[model samples]
Target: MHGPEPGPGEGMGRAVLRGGSVLAAGTLVERLARFARNVVLARIIAPDQFGLMAIVLAAIALFEALTEVGVSQAVIQNRRGHTPEFLNVAWWINVVRGVAIFAIAAPLSPLIADFYGEPALGPVLAVAFSTMVFTGLMSPKVYALQRQFRFGASVAITQGSGLLGTALTLVLGVLWQNVWALVLGTVFEAFVRFVLSFLLCPIRPTFRIDRESWRDLFAFTKGMFGLAFMTFVVAQADVFVLGRLVSAETLGLYAMAVTLAMFPLTLFSKVVQPLVVPILAAFQDTPDALRATYLRLERLIWLFGLPMAATMAVAAAPLLTLVYGPPYAAAAAPFAVIGVYTVVYMASMVSFSVYLAMARPELQRSFTLLRALLLVVSIYPLSLTYGPVGASSAMLGALVLAMVLQVANLRRIIGLRARAYLGTLGGGLVAAALVGALTAALGLLNLPVLTLAGLSVVPLLAVWGLLLFRERHEVRALRRRGGGAAASDR
Candidate 1:
């Protein structure tokens, strides 16, 4: 079996364990900080205020997404990705994109605000969107770290900057008690991230352009731009559509649910997605090794994700009410549905990264386009009928369809059969079933809300322990022989 030749300190299993721990720990801390910030801010600020800020963020995301040029992906995937000329060219292109987004968004904010019937959104959006400029100026060397599997600096820059931003947001939220806290906090986080990028990487990009460099960078952007745009539409369509359909207070409740449901996905985005490209790129030349590694990762994601989905689907209402108070409990239903959606979404993410490693971003674009179209077609009608639940359901439907397309693409490209794909999900399904059964049985005891949630996950945890016990031999083998060799041996 052809396999990735693990270099010193770069065994596939070892790299995943080491890098995953850094990214996961950093992301967990950052997410917890943000969660604390939200819990505090939600109490201080009214629902309508959060709704207004959500609109502001959605508009800013739209403008920035339009200009996304896949610079980071390019830097990671290209052979000359770390060269000074290539990095410089990437910086210039991104800076130009950022400036353009700001200029257009600032002027258009008034019209966007008018559409949403919140005239105050105009200024808030203009200020929040300036983050595009800051992010554009960030050093491309951050992506270079991933290419080399060096994650410590990247995690430090991300979590350290994020913690600072969270603290600032909390301070301002206490003082202001309004939507400005959310807007300003977001802008601050971007600015800090940009500054820290330079400090950690210490690579100053000059105003230099090269034809070959531009060609290499822009080559990846073709499908990336489309994929990015489609992803934005899928990501923000619920808020964008529901803001117009429902009251601001209702929209706020829905937005809160989205945050809660997306908790798992947020970690996936920060940790797994970033690692996918560089890790998989190592096996790009060997289809068997690529497929094997991809399946193993997907299986691991499902093992955890499925149980999380089960807990969210069964216990989200009680959990939300327990943590955020009764005022936000209205978010629970949508949270439950969206939580299950996370599994499908994360599974697709693994495949998406595989496609990128193979330089087949167009495939990613195609599936995302399918999702965008589904969302656009279904969101309005669903929101009109079922309110936030319907809106969340619309997104779930769209993503499910897109994931189906992705499975088909995986088969054609890597020869991953449907049966093999289904097999990876089996353990997760069993764990999810155990959680559901345990939750159902626990409901008979008249437990307190939080206690019920706490008990509901017990079976899931046991299942995880059992799975780990079963894998002990493989774990030891990996430690002895290295991850790539051990995996290929299996």
Candidate 2:
């Protein structure tokens, strides 16, 4: 079953590097396609179209939060995760939750539309939310692929769906020039992923709901649902509060600001996170190895994320002007503020992944609940006073608050000292600060806008590159440790 004993040149290090590379390349292509679609659609459609779609998406998020059973996560965490009976029951539960969410959301669509006072959204929400049905039916066996380190095929299938959805959305946006473009794109994304799961995944989950499966499923779901609820609150609270506080155009601008500000974080979660969870799970029995892996990934994530966040913050005004044009200029301030939030959010997220890897979802629930509570208290007044800027500031506050809690938990759960996290993250902080300071200093001089931007970005990227090169040995050591453990484990 296993390949020949890895030679000196090959081991866990090579395995991880190869898998990580596959994930990175696939994620990059997927993100580029999606980003290009967003850019073109932003240019084609009015800002208000994004605003209306935001409302629909928020409603869908609410239903998902309420119904999340942690089925996918259960599969990832449970020992018998790959068994046919286990997978089949989880698949059925997922399908049921999807149907239940649609059933609950359908009648409430009118209420949500009325809440936003956008009558046109009622029909669109109903139609768009039906995609969850397809999503619910997606094969649970996909998690097994990641678990087995067959990521190349997994990435291909997943990214293929993303590419298809992006192209479909682009076509609709260019032709229809309406909100339906986003609606169609999202629905297509769900549909395509569902179809691909069946084609690509090795296992086929037939209809079943055994008692053993339910027990395993509920054991994970209980805490997961709480985390999902709090996550929904934390994620959507801004839009919910802003929808009431500001005009649709203003809300659209704020949404775009948050999107661009958190671009790197979003991508990390999409690409890098899938790798971290399964890899860390392999090190669950070895404390030193787990910690080493955690620290390495935390640094690796920030190595890339911090500078990107800083660049977004520094070039906010110009980037907005250049990318989405002049109409979005007001978003520049909020973009800068939310950019700071991205740094904190990404850090806390890495720690949270540790909890998930260790099978302690309750810790994650606690962090999410704490952040949600803080956001609930602050988002209203902050949005009232500072508008998008205030909302972004409030988000940063919640991330900081939750990070402190997460650090304390990590200390207790894994016996990791606060100093270790600080030490690991220090390099990224220094590099990002250097990049930010350089960009800020350069901005003081009077020069052509494009030339100034180019001058600021070109050198700092090289600095980031050099830092990454210096860390090469550290990365190799971490991977070797992780790979050795994973190989022995197999």
Q: Count the backbone clashes (under 3 Å) in each candidate.
A: 0, 0
lDDT, candidate 1, residue 195? 89
Which one wins on lDDT? Answer: 1
**Candidate 1: worst 10 consecutive residues by lDDT?**
1-10
Q: For model 2, how does the per-residue alpha-carbon lDDT over 263-333 read when each residue is reduced to its tens digit? A: 77777776667767776777777777788778777777677667777877887777776667678878998
Q: Which stretches of candidate 2 lie over 4 Å from their true place?
A: 1-10, 487-489
Candidate 1 has an lDDT of 0.81
Please write out the lDDT profile of model 1 over residues 1-490, one tens digit for every residue: 1113335433656766677789889989999999988887778888888899888878877887887868889888886787788888888888899998888888888899999998988888878889899989888887876765567878988888899989998999999988888888888999999989888876666666788988877778775876787889999999999899999998987787788788879988998788777767766778887887788778888887898788778777777776667787788888888998888889888889898887778778888888999998999999999988998899999998888778888888888898998898898898888877777788789988878867876777787788789867754443333345333322
Give the Cα-based TM-score of candidate 1 against the true structure. Answer: 0.94
**Candidate closest to the true structure, highest TM-score:** 2
- Kindly give the stretch of ten consecutive residues in candidate 2 with the minimal lDDT sum: 1-10
Counting only residues 3 or more apart in sequence or on different chains, how many pairs clash (N, Cα, C under 3 Å) in candidate 2? 0
Residue pairs in steric clash, candidate 1? Answer: none
lDDT of 2 at 418: 82
